[model samples]
Target: MLLPLPAQAAALDGSQLSLLWGVPFAGILLSIAIWPLIAPMVWHHHFGKIAAAWALAFVLPFTVVYGLSATAHGLVHALVAEYIPFILLLTALFTVSGGIYIRGNLHGSPLLNTGILAAGAMLASFMGTTGASMLLIRPLIRANDNRKHNVHVIVFFIFIVSNIGGSLTPLGDPPLFLGFLKGVTFFWTAGHIIWDTLFLVGTLLVIFYLLDRFLYAKEGVQRQDDPTPDTVKFGFNGGRNFVLLAAIIALVLMSGLWRSGISFDIYGTELTLQALVRDIGLIAVIIASLVITPYSVHEDNQFGWEPMKEVAKLFAGIFLTIIPVIAMLQAGTNGPFGAVVRAVTNADGSPNPAMYFWATGLLSSFLDNAPTYLVFFNTAGGDAVHLMGPMASTLAAISAGAVFMGANTYIGNAPNLMVKAIAEDRGVKMPSFFGYMAWSAGILLPLFVVVTLLFFR
Candidate 1:
């Protein structure tokens, strides 16, 4: 039996809320960005608690001011409607990908590294970014273990495989999946942003090739003692997980395609039949991955729950704290974020494609891109048909920006940090938060400008 909500429950009005309500959101993001750099041990041990405290910082005061009913409604909506499904899909992908171990290593020549990156880019659009990253990152690291200048390789991996490579389809990234759920056709992104994706990814690949070649030669003919010696043969362990990965793709597609007019309302959040089935199926996939995969494969992969646990904890806080921030964005021209709305609109009141690209991309760099996509999407009138047709350029700009520029920061996408953590765990010294930005700012930002000019303009 379904339980009842409070009699006076209703949605929070963004127009009525002030910008002070956004503090916890900003605080948590800053903490994620800064805390680790300033105090690594404390942040590492207590990051989850820090995230929860920020979540409560918003919830407690909001409940006091708005009443318990409204607070409960907001929490339910964020958790049930958004966070649960988001994390479940990520978990399934992480688990299945973690199960499969690439058994042999290759020499990390610039050409071979580039080839692996290109292959990962193609696989990303099919398997999801997290899946592709988890499956390929270790092998790439193992291949490059003997090189003196290998940090660039991992950074480029995050750029190509973790972020930009995911631009081709909804399965590639969370923001795109959210677009698919919002009535976008299955192939809409592939059709709309194919050329744009090709330009950005191709250019980055060329740049990576040249830079890697330079560094490879600079390190001289002699190499360090190879930590992970290359095997004569290359193959995969836990091959069954590949089928589970395919099942995950099928389940995501089915949820988008199937229409059952059946849904249940729980605490003002609508729970649809297809969505429930998809989430349940994902749970099964996770269990099956853990059960069917051999322990040796996981041992070889060094697969553990730390990365997944970290993502889950950090994002739980992100989703909860972002409630009011998203509410304000939803309020549009009348809310605290009114200036953001006006920036993306032309003087003639038509949507400006370039502004949509930058606005969505910039905000997405700081905020979670999924909800950022939704915000700009609604600001563009929330008509899927219209956006897909007459305002196709506008939609393309938003889609490309959200998917591509997530490389701007580690927190821009979930997999960015996961890949970083994995790299660090493998003893690859990653750049600091701002240090990483120096890399993105120098490399990615210039390319984004070119993208803006070539495609967005």
Candidate 2:
């Protein structure tokens, strides 16, 4: 049961429950524990049957811990506290291990692949970063079809599909939803449209130039004796799933109409109209997609379930290992500043949303973006003066910054790792955990620096 904030805080302070931090930290340690078992397999792309293995390694732990926490008396507070972070983690896992194609196809030119890739990246923000990444990864690998250095292609895809692509609207990313929840005008986030579009175009063009150069370098290695692989065509396979994908989008939009908030009905019954609407809507979309997509999958000779299996495997690990960590962080938060060491306000009494953005976003990348957004949002709201427009806009920017930038690392955004897993399945080599960060530090960090100037300054 979801307890209100005041009730939650009262429960925590009243119960002498200071050890709650252990739960989330334990979850992190657990993730590290299984890295050896799963990381090697993913690196070599031995993903033929990784789903079952991942289930045992990751999901089992998450389930047991979550269940234990759910019933352990005071533990309920920690579990509910970490709910948003849990969802973000799940979303990242699903996105990274997307259910779409992952193995390279027999045919498609590099230029053609890049074009398809760009379109897919743009589409990812809408279908969710995971959905788009899963659908396109296999085709992307096939399009690059024969490039020896396919890792570069997959890395750029992470930058576009997993990160920058989700900046368009609230539907594009969860951080944007944080803004929406705070009474941010939906159209207000559209103000980011121009900057978001520019970044997307720039990122794609940069990828194209780099990919073309890499592909060109391999021209000399071709031999006439080498057999040409069979070519694959776009919109030729699983094209019908696109319609189901649209249905999912519709369901998500409808969920917005019914949000859970503090309200009561007649007879003092707690009527959670919003929660019911969203929960049911999400269930409908997932069910419809699963049912509808299989019908056309075999007609295109694309019925192997590698991508979906990979998602199940990797996410199971993520879900378990991070639960304790999210729980602890939830307990650690005391208020606006809470236990976080950061500036919360300026000399003139304005909420320091920029600092909140950076601090929250950096932690969100490593920890959990959803709660990280909330922690900072809560802190910003602590200032009595921040209840209005400019302050609200600042809070929105901070929320957006945290959610959007969380995609900067593989583990940052919910969909990132899913994209990586899908890319690996398709025979594209994604970077190691830390190796990917180097790219983000170089490219994404610079972009955020510009954002700091353009938006916050």
Candidate 3:
């Protein structure tokens, strides 16, 4: 069930791509990492233009070398094959989840926060990292808003809800979704990484529980002005969007299960019928949720399009600029990045599942994990059948690495940044870029090492 490569008239030679082609991608990454700290006003106001500049930096040179037609094919390939579907799915999840507000005035406690985190982790594999994050983050934040020392709640929220929770299914993480589209079965990830996921989630929950308990003890009592009533009764508003959420899930599943062999040739890229249906259906769901759901629901959720816009603009630059980098990795020993390829392989030429895990995870911690996953997947021989057969462990390693280590940094996945921005806007003073990394370095890295030894070994 491997999708056919686009029949491009003039395929760019990855071997011919110089390492300098990576500069634009690096530029965007640095901008994302550094600009927000050094010049917050400039980044907030002009980040889109900056992202577009980096994209054009890559696209312009590519057009000059590859001709307008081939350049059109590449753009079309990135959009049709990757970006459009990606943003649409995100939009659907963001919109649908935004409409359904968890209306309550409940105070957050160690037990309650951990319980909420555990529930969100379960919902992630089914609703998506983005969907589940959007649905739960505000509630979690609101629950702990009155607490004096509540930053760690948001941090662990990112750790579990935004990253590790999504390891179980394609719906959970973008990388897994890319794998599914590239012909990995839907349940393939759940089957391969079930134990690893459970172990990591269990251990993290235990650690989070201890940390929250210690912090809870320091807060002498709830603030005098805390609005959360002692006997608050919880209810869900915008219940209509729940059906729409189910529709989104159903459409995604349909795209995978019901391949009618129908497809369209869009500038040499083949867009299958089911894929088209899925995207169109998702778009419809987004529109319906926006139109049907009352504006009050969004207001209650404090929903704004700024975070979504940031993600879309930034990722547009990322998907476009990453072309050369992915091409180089796929080129293996024949390309400028041959050392990267060699490092992930055994001397016998067999795949090293452990190296694949760490290499993919570390890079994914910085790069967009979807394309990062694609690079290593192609490196491990892009045949889905073989990858699921003899190379199951390697695929599992890649899957686990890409999804889990996304918590290692803010931009590792889109939701991490979104959750941070949302939290900060709600008055949580989030850590600076390197400061956040300091948190992950001490917390997640050791846990990941243990996960590596226990499962990847």
Each prediction's RMSD to truth: 2.7, 7.2, 2.8
**Residue pairs in collision within model 3:** none
Those runs of model 3 whose alpha carbons end farther than 4 Å from true positions after fitting are 1-8, 218-225, 230-232
The estimated TM-scores of all candidates read: 0.91, 0.68, 0.92
In order, candidate lDDTs are 0.86, 0.52, 0.86
TM-score of 2: 0.68
Shift in Å, residue 270, candidate 3:
1.3
- Cα displacement (angstroms), candidate 3, residue 394, comes to 1.8
lDDT of 1 by residue, 294-378 (tens): 9999998788898778778987888788888877876878988888778898888788999999988987886667767877887
Q: Candidate 1 regions off by >4 Å?
A: 1-8, 217-227, 366-368, 378-390, 425-429
Q: Report the C-alpha displacement of residue 246, candidate 2, in angstroms.
A: 2.7
How far residue 58's Cα lies from its native spot in candidate 2, in Å, is 20
Best-to-worst order by lDDT is 3, 1, 2
Model 2 stretches with alpha carbons more than 4 Å out? 1-114, 177-188, 192-197, 200-204, 207-211, 214-228, 231-233, 257-271, 295-341, 382-388
